[model samples]
Target: MPGFYYPIYFFQLDAIKHGVSVTFSFYSLVILNASNFVGRVTSGYIAVFVGVINLTIVATISCSVLNFGMIGLNSLVSVVVLGVFYGYLSGVYAALVAPLITTLTPDLSELGARMGITAFFVGGIGVLIGAPISGALLTSKYIWWIPAVFSGTISLTGGMVYIIMRSMFIRHQFKSQA
Candidate 1:
């Protein structure tokens, strides 16, 4: 989530360097935000049927793949397309994260504390390091792909962690029932 923000923040510069028009560059940002809005609204309603954790895992994985696709794209159209896809998927993942956390916590009374602690750790670390790492990659020139790869890998890893946690939770539930 925060990982994706780094590239988006630098998108204007990137688009200009790639010979994309100023109008389209700004449109790229607008398209991303608009699609993100749609994704957030739709995902919330969809989560009721599909489950928040499952939806989040799918969205994260999709965002990861889209981020990877961003690396090989040099055309304005390609970048815009990928940006819209990434925005939508990322929005879904972001919207569901809080609800997923709430579902995972065992005690309703401790939900706020759990959410606060989780947010502090994930947001604190991600916000602190994500931009710096992306900046470093951009400065390297030869290693520009590193930022996309790194962001995608992080998103993929997060999804895997969620999958594992979900499996463990299911196992525990079954054991208690048995």
Candidate 2:
């Protein structure tokens, strides 16, 4: 798929005649993989104190900015910058998953049960679908009507949902206290 898609996107810009096939590809993947590993390890160690929303908000914002910028990249330098930023951001994203769920449910034993049911059925689909659908979108330049547009839109929507739900929960908490 990268082989098929890279050429088209490569041709679209003057910086990469063949896109980032050789050195940059490996470098990009390494950066992303290393960051993901670090994020997960750190999240595992220090998740007791930080709120899940805060960590995930950082990840989502980073991704939103990078993904949006990736769409706008026109030069080799921009591509490299995009890769580094995206890798680090996605790394943070990997770190936030467990805390996000654990905090949402917040019962040690019960967290297991809740995450199991939700992760496999609901969250699994997002991971499954986000890529293929975005890949299908060959045109997202002007109107952002393709996969990238949809991905960013979903991220924004998720943020909105979090805010609304958090507000409702807070209101409930206040009323209960009252």
- The number of the candidate with the highest lDDT is 1
Best by TM-score: 1
Clash number for every model? 0, 1
Worst 10 residues of 2 by lDDT: 1-10
C-alpha positional error of residue 105 in candidate 1 after TM-score superposition, expressed in Å: 1.3
Reference-based lDDT, each prediction: 0.77, 0.56
Q: Which runs of model 2 end up more than 4 angstroms from their true locations?
A: 1-18, 43-50, 139-145
- Per-residue lDDT of 120-164 in model 1, one digit per residue for the tens? 676678768877877878784645578778877876787787789
Off by over 4 Å in 1: 140-143
Tens-digit lDDT track for model 2 on 1-178?
1111221232233223336555555455555556657666666455455556766666665566555555566556665666556655566666676667776773588988877777656777766666556556644353333444555566756666666766776687789799
Model 2 earns a TM-score of: 0.72
Per-candidate alpha-carbon RMSD to the true structure: 1.7, 5.5
